[model samples]
Target: MRTRLAAVAENFGRDLDAAYATIDRLLRRARAEGTGLIALPEACLGGYLSSLGSAEDRGTAETRRQRSGPPALALDGPELRRVQEMARDVVVVLGICEDGGTDRYNTAVALTGDGVLGVHRKVHQPLGENLSYAAGSTFEAFETPVGRIGLQICYDKAFPEAARTAALDGARIIVSISAWPGARTAAAADLAQDRWKKRFDLYDQARALENQVVWVASNQAGTFGSLRFVGSAKVVGPGGDVLADTGVDTGVAAADVDVEAELDAARRAMFNLRDRRPDVYGALVREPAHA
Candidate 1:
């Protein structure tokens, strides 16, 4: 019933050694702490530099090694196998540039002892990502020994449908891995001020409060080229409380997440699925106003 989850706000740029080292550290720490689930930033294995151009760009053996190489193996490649070795009864979720047959995807990989559960391709690939990645088509919940977990990437969290579907499908914890550009933070703060902060700020909090499930996000930190990844990786409870968070540097955030508590809150809460008027909602969707 009680699960401890860890999120590492990592730096994923052009350095693969640093990235791998960061993951290694997090794995050791999570194991020592007996963390049930560990989540790493988007592109944690490599960095956010994974794109068609970078993957194809001819470079030295070292340069080629740094790139996510061929995208196809992004999900089940040697890099993941190395990472999987670090798994010690803890479910590790990390992001990678996924390759799907003919196209590439910004995907998040979930791994446990049994093996890789499934890959959740970023449904809503953002601006720069759209150029190099394909959008994900399917949505489903994953059943793990830790609990019923669901995976999502950065931009996908901005949409309500994905989280709602995850919740409706019985996901106790919604894990989102992101590389959200930090450039928007200041502009967003200037626009919304402290009242709202970032545009996706509401989305992060709402995903937990609305779905009545634990919302955990693993985000990038530090600088990647011109982008400054915000390191506010957080764990929000079903009651909308931030259980744990980290500063704007490479670090880890963790908290005790209870599935039974989330389920209890969802059932007892009046605004969740139990209180929804599906019949009326169906009618509203069926009858559209004249445009």
Candidate 2:
């Protein structure tokens, strides 16, 4: 079946209620445009921290408290229940701060009317993110109405092993939700010209090409406190082509394609996953020299 998917690039402040309302509005827009699977920005449930402990932040104790991020919620929390209700028609993959027992995790979950399909606790931490949440241990893909889908939060996509593990586990599509920002030092007059935007686009294409899988990338947009996000949400085909994109703006980027057929076509040439490579790549697991 030819399916339509979207990656949303937008801003959501530190208000959970406001975030819910924003999601409600986006869902309506996506449904109207016939999007079947939608990927939302990281921390879309509320908002990411103003500063990930940048030197500009005040007292260490206070910065730690503030950067801890939105109020964490349980799997069956009211916020998600409301989303589950609204997700009756399409599948949604988005990020949130998860409250489980005594620990908080940087988590992403895929949901539908049938309830949660899969959940991924972000495994990689960048900058001061480790101060805020617990790291996940594994990467596994799950079956959904869309296809065998895998979830990866920001920073995880930077490591080739992350997506390769998912593709090896039978994932046909991977969604990476991020709160990525532009160059912190080189302030560009135009956000689109930011160097980080170039890196973001490169990673999305490389990951898709190497895995021969559909890639959906969503990110936060606009400025939030000290951070200015580079909104470059996009969907990449199995052959590393950008199918749709929202460059430096807050909007939904959608594309319609036969995902399985694309994957098959891409794999027919190289069979990237089928070609065994583990025996020659033990160095990947070893400690590396600092640059």
Candidate 3:
């Protein structure tokens, strides 16, 4: 079946109602245009930028404690119900701060008419996120009406294993929800800016080429507090070609990714699942490359 996919960057912060309204409008637009699935930026459910800043500020402790309550809503709560209402004809994927039983988690939830399919807690929390989040252990793909879809959080996309495992499980497209911070030029001549951000941009392209699958990277835009998210949302085809891209802005970026064509390209390249040597890979895992 032909599939039209959308990747959106929701740049607003702490404005849950406004974000919901924007998403509802986008959902209607996608369905009207015949799109199959829609994915939003990381932490699009509530908001990112989780910093209390100064410890001396009055009521700071109470504010943080309160935030950890109601408005952060559980998966089966009003927040998800609102999302389910908007997701009548399309499958939706989004990131949220999950209020797990004992601790909170950075999670990606897939919602459809069939109800909540699955929730993947982010494996790698990155930098200072460990302060309030727990890492996820499960990784797998689920069958969808459109096609097999995979989910990944921001830092999880940086690991090749994360995407490859999903591909091996028959996911034709890996949808990643990211709030990757935008990069800026270094102020000093002697200092070199970390190139990982650029590497991330390129990795999305390379992952699509290597697995011969569609790679959708949806990132947040603008500043949510102190952190400025990189708003470059994009879609890459099997041959590592960029199919659609959105500049640094809060908007919808879309493209028609032919799932069958991607599989066809994998078959043509002879570099897909059928060709991997699993027996020898075991030895490679046991031996260290160097002293």
Candidate 4:
């Protein structure tokens, strides 16, 4: 069945109340547009850390003391219930900082009025992100009304194995949420010409193409502290063509696609999964400590 999917490239600051309001607004807009599924930027609940400051001034100690991090909500908290209520009809994927024991995890939740369906804790951390939260170990996918879906946050999209593992686990569509920013030094005057934006776009297409899955990507727009986010949210086809995008602005990127047909056609010609060279790529499984 063909369905409308949406990705939000909108700005979300540290204000939790404002974030919820924004979510409510965007979800309503998506529903109005007949979107079955929608994805929001990473740390959309509260917001990402203030800044990845200089090495000498920043670390785990600094990220902890200076950066208060998110509200640290539980998996089945009141906030999630509120979101579920807002998503009574449509499926929504949202990023949040999860409270797990003594640790806080960079997490995303897939849910509807039925409540939680799937949860994905971010596996990769770039810059000093590892200092703020604990990393997730597994890349798992779960079933939804739209299709088998997987969730990955920001840096997780940079790792090919992240999406590959989800695809191998039967993920037909991957929702990647990010708070990605422009290059620290050589940032382009034009948002479209930004180096980080280019990488962000390239990666979205590459992940969808390599995995032969529908890619719905979302990112934070505008600036958050010192980091200027490159909001190029998009929905990419199995063949790596971008179907819809929000460019570098604050808006929702939505596109309709026949998920099953797209995946089938992309794989029919050349099955990237079927013609695997696992025997030669034995090094992939070896412990990272050895590498």
Q: Work out the TM-score per prediction.
A: 0.84, 0.95, 0.86, 0.95
lDDT for position 55 in model 4 = 58
1-291: candidate 4 lDDT, tens digit per residue: 789999999888778889889999998888888999999998888888767644533656435634566677788999889899999889999888898877789899999999899999999987777777889998899999888999999899999999999999999999999999998887899988999999999999999999999999999999987889999899999999999999999999999999999999999999999998898997787888855
On lDDT, the leading prediction is 4
Ten contiguous residues minimizing lDDT sum, candidate 1 = 188-197
lDDT of 2 at 258: 98
Candidate 3 residue lDDT tens string, 1-291? 568888887685667898798788889898898888888888887787444233322353235444442235588988888888888868888888888877778888888765787678899776556555668876689887778878899889877778888889988888888887754344222212335356667878878877778888888887666566667688888788888877666777889867887779667857666787787778545756674
Clashing pairs in 2: none
Q: What order do you get sorting by TM-score, best first?
A: 4, 2, 3, 1
lDDT of every predicted structure (CA atoms):
0.74, 0.89, 0.76, 0.89
- The C-alpha stretches of model 4 lying farther than 4 A from their native spots are 53-66, 287-291
Model 1, position 90, has a per-residue lDDT of 82
lDDT of 2 by residue, 1-291 (tens): 899999999998779888888899989887888888999999888788777658744454335655545878788988888998878878999888898676778899999988999999999998777767779988999999998999999889999999999988999999999999888786787888888888888999999999999999999999897888999999999999999999989988899989989998998978989896789998888888773
The ten-residue window of minimal lDDT in model 4 covers 53-62
Alpha-carbon shift of residue 132 in model 3 (angstroms): 1.2
Per-residue CA lDDT of model 1 for 1-291, tens digit only, reads 678988777777655677678778888889898899988888776567533233354555345444454334556567788778878578999888775676777788889766798678888865445555668876689898788888999878887879988888888888989886654333443322432225446677888998888888888876665566667788888877778887555678899877787668656746586676676667444645664
